[model samples]
Target: MDFFNFLAFYLYVYKFFLPKIGRVLLFREKRIGISQQGESTLEEEKSQIRHGVETLVTEALHISKGVLGDNLTQTSQWCEKKKEEIQKRNWKAINGSYISSIGERALSGRLAFLPLFPALPPQILWSTVSSKLKTLNNTSS
Candidate 1:
């Protein structure tokens, strides 16, 4: 399979296996008398997911190198560049910009009832919110 397909398959498998891994980790933690709350904290879950992704990427890179030989160098470099790009991303700034835009629209009275009413033409804010709410409802149910 191509790199995108390979990456996606690994992600799918990782997601499939993650719960089993979490169970094993929880079992070990209980045996050691740690994690007395009987649940993994959010940070611990994030750490496990991050580590799992890193491991999958590293394994994929090795397999690609074996299959592609000399051509894999470019792919490895591209992966590293993309990793750097992801690491350099400023999520807070991005969120701030989105919130500021919404605030500006609201203050200008263009989106007076943002949560209840849709914005004027050329903006699909209500549709976005509707879809998001549907997704949340589906997930919760």
Candidate 2:
């Protein structure tokens, strides 16, 4: 698959797996469940998710910049639209993969671009994408 597909797969893995990992790991301990180590592991996983998300965002921004320039058109619209979809749909989805985004900030960040794609459900996905576009606007300003 391409880079965007890679990113989507990466994010999906972390987004779905991290929390489940944390739950299982933490609960595997004592009757009370969740040792200090388990908690720390969860935190570490969260940190990794955050880092991965940042990397994903960086790569996407780089791609958009390369393809869309400072201006957007139909030719380059998919990148920005995809960005919005990611941000909007999975602001919450990213929460579990060892890290998370506050939904409002993420949504605001992604919505910075216009002529965004129209899609169904999966709010966090859309939010992610919209946030990416927003952040790029912030950087340019």
Candidate 3:
């Protein structure tokens, strides 16, 4: 399987385990809390809570990286860098164009990202749906 797809599937699987891990950690803390019986200082309590949080985060990251492996992690980073490079090049091309007005240029940039719907103008889709609903209402009445 492709790395991205495999990574997504792995994350989906981990979603179930991640919460279970958190609940286990929280239960452990509660047990610790009961055992301490307020004997621990405020700073100590804070430290324990912080440690719990850090452990949870570390475990989550460790799980992600552990399954994906360092090479896949590096590949993901490389893909992100390439995506950024392409976006920068595209943006430069758009901004450097001869479009005189700022508003027009901005609109062109916006349209570039928009999916094409050549079959109908934007308003026509809404108007068509509304007309169909009106016709249905008339027939029902």
Candidate 4:
């Protein structure tokens, strides 16, 4: 259980919720020369990767399960921060404000339309935060 292990499971959950995205867990190894022993090693590597992902989902809930749970519980902090910035019009002078605004509008629309879908509310909420953060990133770029 580690950061990369947690990331692997995060991606797996996303794939489960959005199956159309067609994400797969991949294990990459490069060997200059192939042998029967090497093939067996490859199979073992794949098995380990699969087990790691399964552990993350079924038992661990990410290597940082407690940390992730705490993080999720702080969702209100995020909304409060965003709501404050919106009230302040903090990005009015930023050039990427348009993209930020577009994302905000998109998120608002998504929230308005998708609350009944159970799987989409949290995704839309996080996307909104990420989209707004993208504006700050673009502004600095």
Q: By lDDT, who's the top model here?
A: 3
Per-residue CA lDDT of candidate 2, range 1-141, in tens?
599999999899899988898888777765345567678889999999999999999999999897776465764687888888887677634543323334446556555543364554458666867677577555433
lDDT of 1 by residue, 12-94 (tens): 87998888898999999787665544356656888999999999999999998788976678789999998877745755456
lDDT of each: 0.70, 0.69, 0.73, 0.69
| Candidates 2 and 3 compared by lDDT, better number | 3
Q: For candidate 3, list the clashing residue pairs, or say none.
A: none
Report the C-alpha lDDT of model 3 over 1-141, residue by residue, as the tens digit: 699999998898689878899899999999899777666676688999999999999999999888789779899999999998986777655643432344345456655744775666768755755575566445433
Runs of candidate 3 with Cα error greater than 4 angstroms are 38-141
What tens-digit string does per-residue lDDT give for candidate 4 at 36-57? 6788899999999999988768
What TM value does model 2 have?
0.27
RMSD of 2: 43.6
Per-candidate clashes, comma-separated: 0, 34, 0, 0
Candidate 1 all-Cα RMSD: 40.0
Cand. 3 TM to true fold:
0.24
Q: How big is the positional error of residue 90 in model 1, measured in Å on the Cα after superposition?
A: 62
* Weakest ten-residue segment in model 3 by summed lDDT: 95-104
TM-score of each: 0.22, 0.27, 0.24, 0.23
